[model samples]
Target chain A: MNSILSIREVSKFYGSYQALNAVSLEIPRNSIYGLLGPNGAGKTTLIRIINQITFPDQGQVFLDGEPLAPHHIAQIGYLPEERGLYKSMKVGEQALYLAQLKGLSRAEAKQQLKYWFEKLDIGNWWHKKVQELSKGMAQKVQFIVTVLHRPKLLIFDEPFSGFDPINAAMIKDQILELKEGGASIIFSTHRMESVEELCEHIGLIHRSNLILEGKLSAIKKIHKQNRYEIRWTPLNGTPAPEELLGRLPVIGPHYDAEDNTWDFTLELQDSEKGELLRYLSEHGNLASFRERIPSVNDIFIQTVQKQESHA
Target chain B: MHKLGLIIRREYLAKVRNKSFVIMTFLSPILLVGMIVLIAYLTKVNDNEKRLVAVLNESPFFKTDFESKRGISFVPLHGIGLETAKDSVLDMGYYGLLYLPQRASLEGVTEDAFLYTKDAPNTLVLETLEGIFEDRLREYRLQQLGVSSEEYARVRMGYEINTATFSGQRSAKGINEFKAVVGGAFGYLIMMFIIIYGGFVMRSVIEEKTTRIIEVIISSVRPFQLMLGKIIGTSLAGVTQFLIWIFSASLLMIAVMLFLDIDPAILMQRPGPGGLEASLAQSALSGDDTSQLLVEEFLKIPMGLLVGCFLIYFVLGYLIYSSIYAAIGAAVDNETDTQQFIFPIIMPLMLAIYVGFFSVFSNPHGPIAVAFSIFPLTSPIVMLMRLPGGVGEGGVPLWQLLASIALLLVTFLAIVWLAAKIYRVGILMYGKKPTYRELYKWLKY
Candidate 1:
């Protein structure tokens, strides 16, 4: 796999309290990696290490096959969770300043800022003070600043927060567009729906340890049980047979009186699936049937709970 | 290096562009000049009001002793009784009544004399009245002993011992103290600049932390660079303000002197309340040689060394103090939490000022002054107070001066290193109010 960033046995501590404990992961190139964890489970700390805002106690980080150093800061864009602009400064001036700090020349910063401001439909806000912008508008400005230099990697901590649904979707589209333009992304958030929608790979952190890290689809496939949902309507006015259903490994059987159909869930092994299908055909016509897929949210809660129980 | 320059530029612009800074820069000189003018006018009005004392004398001894002077006038009442004198004095709105009854002897006349007023009389007025009585009694005693008035006047003639340095140059009394005071003014200015601009550094740090901009900044530049940039930038703004104040105040002083039709040279030589100028003026009235020597002595002070040391101490001292300020700013989340840390930082400066003035005035070469001047924290101020004395022989010793500068530079570096550590850790920390113990822990980090 072509990886854009990799961490190996990175650990950090604040006095006696360990923030990260030998945690390690690789973020694939041109892929969105969801860094999932409960609050204060070392997600921010690890992200800070990646950004070089703080160094690790023990371990090394590499970006694009090279050791991470100060120069790599220019290659990464970080939108911290607690982010803001100089409230009294004009939007355009503040953006230019941030861009310049990120190693862009003045003229280049101005040109890029102009393009982003127009692209975000906030061109009129260039001369307005940041204090005059609403929270969502400010988020948009911050997003533009984070991506202005066209970094090789982008890290956003809860980027959707403080954004309304329509703006949030707009930002989501922009993130995908940036991915299409070939930038690796690390998304640290508790929102599983966005993760399900955007991430191709994920790492779950619990108690300062990476409990799971792999392709999102592969993890889901490994977590799924042989559970299937079935819907059928009785033909020829035949009543439902409770004994046969009870004999099988069936759960949550419900009969919809308006539609005259039976809805139920069944867990089956590979060999027993053919027998169940034949029985279902004889008893009533099979309306619909599909295997149930465990969502990222369910896997997250279940993994964390199982870890807690073991501890 | 380029990023540090950018940080410094931004910080300087932020401070200079602030409205309060601009207003204070322009308004302070006007306020200071107005206050000085008001004080001078008030002193003149106070000096103009002469107290009137009504003298009711039944004795023939003190007939001519009640002559008027600059601040007090006495009117003699020949036929009025003591009660009538008091009533008339009150009716005429006079300051007081001085009653002298007939006595058989000079001492007896003074013993019976009494001065009464509606309230406790002004001490100065009372002293003048008593001085007249005392002088007359002395004259009377001398006359009884067969000394004539002219001889008595000769006996009471004032005298002052001539003073000169061992180098055969005439030296006025209080000139050393005057020089020390002049140097102390520079020292005092340095302290104010450190405190005022150091406070700016601290508040600017706190502002960035509170606004959540510090992380973004430090990510682009080292925390040490940012802290140092802030100190240098804020001090530059302070220097700008100081330059404005000095320029405008001099202009205002010249205008006021011109409006009053006063010569600047005469004003410089004018006798102040009590100082080298007063004593020098007294001697200058007698001979041209002494006045020329006075001007020579004033010019002989090592002004070049004083100014050079001032710039050195100003930069180094401000760096040391403001780094601590920046550290404190980073350790806390808000301005209110800074109270606990500010006192220790200001204590050394206050000690330098008060102790420096006292010791440097009495004995510039004293051990106390030398020790304080060599100590890193207080040296910036106390050392300047001694620099006006010159360098090698009578002024600050060369070794002490070198040691003071070396220690200040070292202390500045060490403090900045420690401050940067705390700042690096603290800017990212939120919510909790950090303690000194926590700051120490951060230093390790």
Candidate 2:
């Protein structure tokens, strides 16, 4: 009941090539779930299945506890990685057409489109052909159309591409705002930085299989390795005491002779952080100490590379 | 259902609003009418050209036999030798020189005659000269046999076999050919419309794929719905253009002919002696009964059935062809790649037109015509060619007509189904140049 969408062992094939293989995942309601995968790793295929653009050759998908059907299309919004509006159509007209196709009435589509266009500060572009719009401008229109129907679940693939940093930040804010409005989102992208900033939960797919899935922080915690980095500088030009730091199972220790400073990383056992802190303080002034957490990017690369080596 | 309507409306508006589509829709009729008018005027001028042949007669025969005709004139050379006559004819830029040498008998004189020209003489002019010689020789032979001139005249009269239907309505010569040509013109229009607007459907699919908007749209509507919408919408635009062309072309043709005081019947002529007009005129000169019978035969054509069948065939034929076009559009990334796939789609339509005209015009009930008219792919063109003769009995059998339409419907459904399969996969595919084998694989997908 807590999950807005659930995919159960979905499998798909294109002729002899298998595009998806027994993949299963769930997205909790009102959370931004990052769909992370390398290029050609069945991420697009999974999203397409969710959108009902294509059906899985073998499996079942449920949206809001009901089997996915044509009616579910109005409840899901998908913005593909490669997206476009009709080039010859007027911006507002094209937006209205797409909205209507998503089950909005003409008057409803028009009113909603007007609200979004003004909110996005593109009110004057209503009559301009899409061909005349700048790439970012067109992206803005696409974004509006995607969310216009106010679907229960929104899927965005590479949404930040072709946008400047400022616009990207603006879009990022809008995405946050949509999520705040209680719409569950499936964010698919190769950019890991965006995932770290935005995603609360994630599913990592590699080679047509779900290799990893959990809360982002929980996954990072599991891969923590109890690793920590410490930096210290000796007081009053005292030479660095490498014997004490080395005896503490320190790794890659560095000594800056000019500044009389030392830096190194280490894996500490349970209840051993106090002992390490005492050793560092007794030897030199401790500059910094922090646990090293693996980023989503690191986890993605490690998982994919591990799978590649195994294959 | 609603989404399909929206897609159809959008597609229709997109095509109709396109600059080239609008230009071609209006401008083409004018170009067509202008071309026909130009050809008719040129043909008139060509037929007006007079060919003068100098006749150097050194015999006491054919004194009044070499008569001047509409396009060929004979000028007798007086007190001139053969070389002098040739020189004068060449100097005057005459068409040719006809020399008749003196002999003891008319047979000897006729045998020694020659018509010499700077280049090869025209076949029509040569035939005219030979006809005159044939008549004179016949008369001389009759005189030698001691037969009276009255008896010779009775013997020389031309004979024509009488014709009638079982119902006793007289039939006219060239009416079958005439009806076939008229129906063939309708068939030709369908082919052109299918090719032109079918191209519109194809290009529209390519546009959506290349723009990468197909994925977004399909996420809202089914791919089959989108493909069907495109074909229907584009064909509606085509039908609109076709109606406008027929209306405007007819209006413009009538206006041009009236303002210039030209006879359209003359335009129908083939522009030389022994042409369609000449033979029809000859038959008319024999008696007015034949011309009246021809007019009745023209009116007896089942215009209502022909028109009704035309609309049916036009829709079915275009649907079948454009679905294939839509699939091709989805399979290719750009227009250039379409060249590899376009020929096969067009082959059936071309075969329909060329084969329909040949087989239908010769014998409407012939095996070639009957088979082509029921073959579904070519039926739209060939069936109309035979329908002008009216259905049942002498015309196309009722079973054949129904079968042709029924087969077209089945074929259209089958093609659209297969095409939708390919379209679903191909629109999402990018960059790769898909072979026929790949398309076949997509059908399975």
lDDT for each residue of candidate 2 in B60-102, tens digit (9 for 90 to 100) = 9889887787788889998989988888899999999999998
How far does residue B13 in candidate 2 sit from its true spot (Å)? 2.1
TM-score (chain A only) of candidate 1:
0.96
What stretches of model 2 exceed 4 Å from their correct place?
A235-242, A246-251, A256-260, A282-284, B52-63, B74-123, B165-169, B271-281, B284-287
Chain A TM-score per model, please list them.
0.96, 0.95
State every prediction's TM-score relative to the real structure.
0.92, 0.91
**Local accuracy of candidate 1 as per-residue lDDT tens digits, B1-445:** 7777777888888889889999999999999987777766656656678889988888868878778876688888878778877898999999999988888877888998999999998877777777777788888899999999999878765455578768776776677787788889989998998889989999999998888877777667778888888888888899899999999998997798779754444323332332223334554455655556557766888888889999899888988899999988988889999999999999999999998878988888899999999999999999999898899876778999999999989998888888889888988889989888888899766
TM-score of each candidate's B chain against the true B chain: 0.89, 0.88
lDDT string for model 1 (A1-311, tens) is 49999999999988898989998899999999999999989999899899888999999999998989999888999999988877778788888888888999999999999899888899999899888989899889999989999999999999999999999999999999999999999998989999999999999999899999999999998999989988987665646546556555367678788888887788878898898888889877899888888999999999999999999
Candidate 1 residue A288 Cα shift, in angstroms, is 2.6
Candidate lDDT values, in order: 0.86, 0.88
RMSD (Å) of each candidate, 1 decimal: 3.4, 3.2
